[model samples]
Every structure is written in structure tokens, then in C-alpha cells.
Target: VQPSTFITHVAVLTQPSDGTAGRPLPRQPVVAAMDAGGNVMTTYTQPVSVKLNRGDLDSVGMVGTRTVTFRAGVGTFLDLRIDRAGCCLHLVFEVAFGLFRGFSEGFC
Candidate 1:
């Protein structure tokens, strides 16, 4: 296999699910580096960062390690949480080496 395949973007493998306020997400988020054909680019091992996408200036804060290193092209955010109750919140995953970004499904 040609290690020449480049990472074109990031993808959310698992979407976060609703959970109690101040508690970890019932389903943690998972992200992956992807090739142009949407295949996991396992050769692309780099740190991916996640952040809360707060559309408005609310006091909502995300609690967890903001960055995770890719393993076999995937990164799982195990301890992600919301500091307060909210609806329609989303998480954005990014990699600094490129213009890649992935958005998670809306969750409470």
C-alpha cells in the first residue's frame, strides 16, 4: 500500500449522545483521518483537537482532553462532558496540519 495517500479531511466515526449535565457523554465521540475517497488514512497519525461549537455566547464549557493522538487513523474522546445542561450542542474536530474539520451530531 502506498503511504502516499494523503489525509484530505477528518470524519466523526461516532456521534456523541445526550447525557446528564456535568456528566460524561453516554456515547463518547470518535474521529478519524480520512482520504479523499473517505477511507481511514491509517498512515496519517497526528493529534486531533476537539472543541465545543457554541453558536451563542453561553456559559457552556466542555470538559475533557481537548486533543487526542490518532491511532490506526482513529481518535476516541472518552471523557467528554458538558459542564451544564444544554440542547443542540455540537463538537468540532480539527487537525492543525491541514484545513480539515469534522462536525459531530447535535446532542444535549
Candidate 2:
């Protein structure tokens, strides 16, 4: 991938969900992509394939929607099922357009 054709900035978002009995509170994993100049590209409407691990999974992104498209430069993965407490999320974003293999780590 060219230097100018890669995602320069990757951001992760985590939301704390109220816990219920016998379930891990699911949280949506949100990633933001930006250019080298740090400008968020809202026009990058592309379905980005992402793999998420060791994090919470919001019910919205579950069931065939683990891979999601970016809307307004932010892609929200609703199927993330986080494992364990005090562990950071590991995510890899690939394909779909204008982005290379980018890794983002976040603490929720």
C-alpha cells in the first residue's frame, strides 16, 4: 500500500453497558479512520472488513454484521463480544476501499 493510500489514524471507542445476570455487557466497537493530515474523511463510505477480539460485543453488530461499513469516517462494529475485564481490544481493519491493514488497540 502506498503511504498516501493507507489509514493514517485509527481510533477505537468503547461504551460501558449495564450488566445483567449471566451475560457480559456488550459494547460497540467504533473505529475512526483519518488521513495523514488528521482530517476525518466522512466521504469514505466503504464496507470495511474488521476482526475484533478481546472486547465487548454489542448486539447490534452481531449476526452477519461483524464486518461493517464506515459512515462519516467512523465504523462501528456491533458484534464485538469482549472477553475478560481489564483487557484492551485488538482489532484489525482490512479491505473495502482506501484502507490498508491497520491495527488499532484501545482500552475500554
Candidate 3:
């Protein structure tokens, strides 16, 4: 399957349903985008200016997810960071082949 476009410099805030409270926040990390061929397409070092505050709950807390989009090519990789309640999280994923194939001799 073709890799989805890279998503960067965006924060996705989510809330849990366990009525739990988290700690203070930290400095946000930069976002990185990768092309389909696994090349660095772009980087987002701008600090995200958005903030989400969820009051103490019995089973809910806010969670953030960032995305970076890039043009299609061959392979892909991405780096993301999330800091909340004095905790930090990082994620990276590699994209393999895609669904669509280029024009070949027989098909054309």
C-alpha cells in the first residue's frame, strides 16, 4: 500500500476516558517530514502555538498527536514528539512500497 502523506507541524489533541489527571507540560519538539524515497522533504521547527487544557477528570486526559505531509516518491520515515505532564513521548515510522505502480510497457 502507498504510504500516506507525511503530516508535520500539527498537533492532534485527544482526551482519555479514564478520569485521570496528568502533570505539567514541556517544550514541544520539532516535526520532520520524509519523502516516499525516505528523503528529508521538510522540517517544522516552529513552536506549536496551540495549547489544550483539560480539567481534572475521573477518567479523561488530553493527548496530542502530530503529523507531517510530503510528496510521494519511494520510501518514507517520520519523527514526532509529545510532552505532557512532565512526560515525553517520541514516535517514528517507516513507509515501504505503495499501492499504485508506474506505467509499464505492457500496460501502456
Candidate 4:
């Protein structure tokens, strides 16, 4: 377990990575956090979620996941299929603790 009030060191993009875009992208953006020790904290399992909000959560009409559980401190945005958003889409990963999160920009 992590110490209370400890800050996460980093957030890494595991899917929908940089320089990869496709119509109807059949993958979800995944973000993982690493402690100061640089190890995957599997015990950090917590319900994680994110969305492709363009100033509106439901603006895209199911283009991204609404919620997904985390495994080994990794949360995946399920059913994330983007094709009509054009470019420069944002993917935010929210951890269960409500203190740690990550963001990434991608194209579709």
C-alpha cells in the first residue's frame, strides 16, 4: 500500500499510443501509474474511468468508454471507437483514488 498523501510519480500511455490512428479505432486508452520505486503496483487496483469529452461528455455519442475497472493500476477505456472526430482527440485516465490521473492527445 502507498502512503497517504503520496503523489504518483508518472502516468504512462499503454494503448492508443503515439503515432497510431485508425478509423473505428478498436482499442481503448490505458494509463498506468508508477510509484517512486518504479514498479507496477498491482495492489493499486481501483475502479478507473475516462471519456472523450469535447466540452460535452455525450457529444460524440458513444465514441469512448464511460467507465472501466483497473487491473494492476491500469485502467482501460472500453469500447473506445473513434472515426469521425477528425484529429487531436483527448484521452484522460482517471484513477479510483480520485487523486491520480493522466492525459494524452491522439489523432483519429
lDDT of 3: 0.27
Error of 2 at 66 (Å): 1.8
Q: Which ten residues in a row have the lowest lDDT in candidate 2?
A: 54-63
Q: Report, for every candidate in turn, its global Cα lDDT versus the true structure.
A: 0.87, 0.55, 0.27, 0.56
- Give me the displacement of residue 27 in model 4, in angstroms: 3.5
Worst 10 residues of 1 by lDDT: 1-10
TM-score for each predicted model, relative to the true structure: 0.91, 0.54, 0.23, 0.62
Judging by TM-score, tell me the better candidate of 1 and 3.
Answer: 1
Which 10 residues in a row give candidate 4 its minimum summed lDDT?
A: 17-26
Query: How would you encode candidate 2's per-residue C-alpha lDDT over 86-107 as one tens digit per residue?
Result: 3344556665553555665553
Deviating ranges (above 4 Å) for candidate 1: 1-4
| Ranked by TM-score, top first | 1, 4, 2, 3
lDDT of 2 at 27: 57
Q: Which stretches of candidate 4 lie over 4 Å from their true place?
A: 1-10, 17-24, 53-64
- Flag the better candidate by lDDT, 1 or 3: 1
Q: What is the lDDT of residue 60 in candidate 1?
A: 89
Instruction: State which candidate, 2 or 3, has the greater TM-score.
Output: 2
> What local lDDT does model 2 show for residue 74?
82
**Evaluated with lDDT, which candidate comes out highest?**
1
